[model samples]
Every structure is written in C-alpha cells, then in structure tokens.
Target: MFSILIAGRLPQINFQQVSETQFVIPISDIDHVNHLVVFMTGQIPFPENYGGGGNWPSAEGPSWIFLGKITNVKPSAIFKIGKIKDIESKIGSSLAPTLFSGFQHQTAIPTDGLLGISVEPLSQLDQQIQPHDITPSTVASNVEFVSKMLNNFVNYVTSFVQNVPGTSEQIVPLSIIQTWYNNFQRRITENPNFWR
Candidate 1:
C-alpha cells in the first residue's frame, strides 16, 4: 500500500514505495490512521469514491436508492501494523478497504457476537503515552471523545442480527467494540511491525 502510495503523492498519500520490484510492509502493527491511504494496487484506486454522483432531490422521489449496497470490501482482514510516534498503533494497508465507506450500514450479521468481550481499561497504555498539556476540562472532553470513538468502533464490530422480539431495531453489544479497540492497542504496542 505504502509502495503504491509513495509513488503517488506526499502527506496526502502516506506510503513508502521503494522501487518497481520491491515494497516491504510489516503486518498488523498500527492502531489508528487518519486521512491515510487504505488500498493501492496499480495506481487505479480500487473502489469508487462515491457511487452515484450528486445529492439531488432532497425529498425522496422516484429514484433508485442504494439500500445496503456496500456489503463488504475486497481484501478481507483490514489493518496493517505500524506506529507513527505520538500516534502509536496507527492503521496501515489492512485498513485500506474501509476507506470507501460513506453513508452505509451493516447488512450481514457478524460471525460471532463480538465474542462478548468487555472494554478493558486502556489507562495503562494512556499512562505510557500521556497526551501533552491537557486542561481539566479537556480531560472530560477527551474521555467523551474516547467514548464516541468506542461507540463508532463498537457499532462497527458487533453488528449482528438479534431480534428484540418486541422492538423493531436489532441489537449488538458496544462492549465488544471496546474490547476490540483495547486489544488493537495492545497488539500494536506488542508487535509494532504490521506496517513497517
């Protein structure tokens, strides 16, 4: 991924393309990634950026809506491993597939119930890499921010069809998502080689 990326642009494209013949990358080392390249084959850019162009007809008209279109991405297990200093365990090539998401939801139920895991405390990891000069209010905000991230990640992982029997909406545990995140951080710190 980085190989193709480095061949393209700069910070706009985070990759380390060596030559035409070789491109080495460590596997599953990163914990998070922001505005980074997800997939890179031969410079064509794998998935489509957005499906059907413009956001016209604010009101629902006689149009073919893309209901649950993006079922899954190509490369299966996402996440290449690597750390970028302050942002340890950042996402790498493995996450390249997810970059295509935009206005979507889970269609198929998960294989496991996220294994029913709990959100392990990452305070130790936090202590190891303390954020700089945080204010008192920032503490609360940061916690809330972490909570939201956990929320999104939870929504991502534990998506399985479980009938409520009474209610219309299905259910999935957020704790499992939290666990995934915690484990991800642990893995990133442990190996720190998925994305070398």
Candidate 2:
C-alpha cells in the first residue's frame, strides 16, 4: 500500500491512501505547503518488472512530467513544492505525444486547481542524461563541504567564552554543544532520516 502525507502551514497535516496506486489531493488542501512526502507501507516488494514514480503537471500542453522513481531502499521521499508560476516558467515544453497519449483519457488529471499524484508500473523512466541532473559524487562533496563549514562555526562559537556570562562555573557548557553536534553528525551519517 502507498500513502501520501502533506504538510501545509505550520501544524496542518493531511494524509491519504493511494488506493489502487492513484490518488488526488486538491490544491487548496496543500496551498502554501511546506513539504510533500510519499512512502510505501506494504510488506510485499514491487515486482521485478515494475517500478514506481510520481507524475507532476506541466505548464505546456497541460501535460505531466515523470519526477523519478522511489525505490525500496528509499521507500520515503520528500519534496518542497515550488510556486506554480515559477514551475510553469522553468518547465519549457510539453512532453512528446507518444509518452502521454495513453494518459489522455484518465480522469486523474485535475481540471481545477487540484494536484494529482499517482504511482504506476513503468518499464523505463527516461534514462537519457539531462543537463539538470546532478551526479552522486557532486551531492556527496556538497554535503561534506557544508558539514565542514558547520563544524568550523561551532568551534568558533565555542572558543568565545566557554561559559555563561556572570557565573563562576560553566553553565550550558561547551562539551554539551560539542556532544550535540557530534551526535547530530553521526546520526546524519548513519541515516539521513533521523529528523524525519
């Protein structure tokens, strides 16, 4: 089974099941949203011949784009929804007719301001490299650089006083801050989902 969790303005959350591998959540429900998360809950794995991915609306031809696959190793995915106007401007042209002809008759495509999400069995997912796609090494290097910068910031802050002001002893000690950062770094290294 698959489920979708949508979070909008602070403290507002919506959940829905993708019954039969398809579901629609009205745009109003997620207006001014913070994040969109999707995951699979079933014990059975996807078939060898089938893979799962999401479909997002395109501005041109009112078509849709495949937003890549969500696999068993990474069952859950999070997305930050961009503004409609920005998305329309960035998404250049509509998809080829051959790719979307089969979906022309589907009722899932929203007419009003509703957002439609679906999981389908796709054999291939446009394997050709796109200029926008980033490599795994690039991501790793970026993460490493950020981690180093954060560590430097923490060390600089800790070096200042090493104790709370106007006190004989160290209140809110430096060790605690260091320990917290170490634990956070370890958790992120082990599994990036700790915050999730």
Candidate 3:
C-alpha cells in the first residue's frame, strides 16, 4: 500500500491485494480534529477474465472509512458530514458537490465514520491496482487458473498414464470446477456426514 500526501494536507491512501486505501490515523496529529480512526481496503474484480462466470467487475481499488463530523444522522445509523478527517470517502461523484448535496445512500458503512456503502477510487487505495489494471484478486484465482492450465498440459504429456489403450483423461475448465463445487455443496448439505 502507498500513501500520497495531497497538497501536503490530504493523505490519499492505497491498498495492496484489495485492502483499505485510507487510514483514520487516529487524528492524533490534528490537534483540532480528534476522533477514533480506522482503515479499510477493498477492490472490484474484473468483470471479464476475473473469475468463473465473471462474478466481479474488472475495476480495482481500496476500501475506505473516512472520519467526518456527523453533519446529519438518520434512523438507519446514517451520518451526514462535517469535514473529511480522512480519505475513506467511499462516496462517489454521483452525490454531493460533484453531483448533489445530499447524504450518500449505501447499505454498509464502517462505524469509524464511513458515510455509505459505495467504495472509493482505485488510486486512493492501492497503487498496484487501478480502474483497469489487475494485480491479484483472490489468492485462489491465480492458483485456480494456473493449476487448471497445468492439469490440461499434463494430460497431454503422458499417454494413457500407463498404456491403458482406448482410455484418456480430459482437462476440466474453471467453469466446470465451479459447477462441481456447487453440486458438492448441495450433496454435502443433504447428508452433512454421510457414511462416516
């Protein structure tokens, strides 16, 4: 993760491997604004070539939990804003001065002063990941992709694995692996511990 000092006042944060882009810093440095601090990091996976069936988006960035004065509060533990004490402004341009002057609407917000459910820009979170760049999504995506490819190549390496005539092995695609996992889950739930 990298932290860039913007105008020598605002610290734009970035995360590695889908972590928080910005940190709370405890606001200990600012004698004027002192509040509990926190950090967040997250990223949007590439919609295509990301995972099987492409569950996530292609964009990448860090998560946030900005600390600001509770300008307004609502029934659903919502806080308006006072001043951005940190860069955890998961708020997008669709709202506020960039778009409108209303509280952002989202499903989840960190208690450390996150405003809404929306996430922040990719640059502020981690330097390695950008809107279109892909460093690494889940530690499993790489393992899965490479292993699957290798398995395919290996199948082509040996003939019949011992001269078993008329018999051969076929490589399975990642999508098929996904389907297998889902089916296995269903079977497991039907018995939980069958035969054992």
Candidate 4:
C-alpha cells in the first residue's frame, strides 16, 4: 500500500493500491501549490526487484516529465508542486481512466489540473533512461563544487565587510557567519539529509 500526504493544507490523505502503480493527483482545490509526500506503508513489499518512480505529465498531456524515484533505500519522497502553466486545459481527458480511477471515489480528479505519479519496475525505468538521471559521481561533484563556492563566497564577503568603514560588527559578524557556513558544509558532508 501507498499513501500521499499533502502538506500545508488540512492534511489530506490519499491511498492507493500497490497493483495500481500509476495514478494522478488533483491539485485544483489546493491552488496547485503544495508539497506531496509519497511513502509505502510496509504492509506489502514491492515484488522482488521492483521500484517506484514518479513523473509530472505535461499540462497538455502526452509528454511526462520525470520527477524522481523511490526505492528500498529511500522509500519516501517529497514533491514540490508549484503553479503549473496553461492549467486551463482539461485534465485526465488525454490520460487513461486507469491512471486515476482509483482515486475517483474519494477526491474527484480535476478535469483541468492534475499531476501524474507513476510507480513501475526498475527494469521498465531503465528502458526509458532520462537525461537528468542522477549518478553517485555526479552528486559528489555537485557537493564538492557547492562547498568550494560557498567557502570562496564567504571569504570574499568577509573581506569586503572588514574593509568597509564605520560598519559595525554587530550588523554582520564575520565569525558567526563563517562558523555557520563551516557547520553547514560539515553537516552536508556528513549527512545527505541536511537539505531535507
């Protein structure tokens, strides 16, 4: 079983069967601005080698944008849904009823605004490789670059602040900011959940 918790509202909960791997969520009532947290209930594990993936289909339909994936290592994921462009188009019309018939009884899938989430086997996802698919090396390089850039930026800003005349240390203390940057960089290095 899987459940979706839409945060920042009345805490709506939507449930879906594991068999119905693909489904759509309606965002019209919430103004299409919220975070969706999808997670497994652990009542049933995914069949041997299966994994779950998510996608945001284009408002016009046909094209689906890859969001991210959920696996045993990372069972839950948070999706930030922002204001979608051209939301006046009819929703679910182009999408098959099987994609969202599961949720029809609880929350009616909006005809004009909907977000699609798909959970499929890892093998199926491998067949359709996305350009932005993440890799371990890519993540490491990004973190290294970010850490170096932050350090350089902090040094530059600190130097500029010190050189300024009549600038009170109380306004912006170099030590505090530098310490904070150092701590943040350390935390990110040690734990990937710092961003969360």
- Which of the numbered candidates is closest to the native, going by highest TM-score? 4
Off by over 4 Å in 4: 10-20, 30-34, 83-108, 126-196
Q: Which stretch of 10 consecutive residues in model 4 shows the poorest summed lDDT?
A: 95-104
Q: Please give the CA lDDT of all the candidate structures.
A: 0.29, 0.48, 0.28, 0.52
Show pairs that collide, candidate 4.
Answer: 91-111
Cα TM-score per model: 0.21, 0.45, 0.18, 0.46
Q: Candidate 2 versus the native: TM-score?
A: 0.45
| Runs of candidate 2 exceeding 4 Å displacement | 8-27, 95-101, 104-123, 126-196
Top candidate when judged by lDDT against the true structure: 4
Rank by lDDT, highest first.
Answer: 4, 2, 1, 3
Cα RMSD of predicted structure 2? 13.3
Candidate 2 on 141-177: residue-level lDDT in tens?
Answer: 6677678757765765556545556877654566767
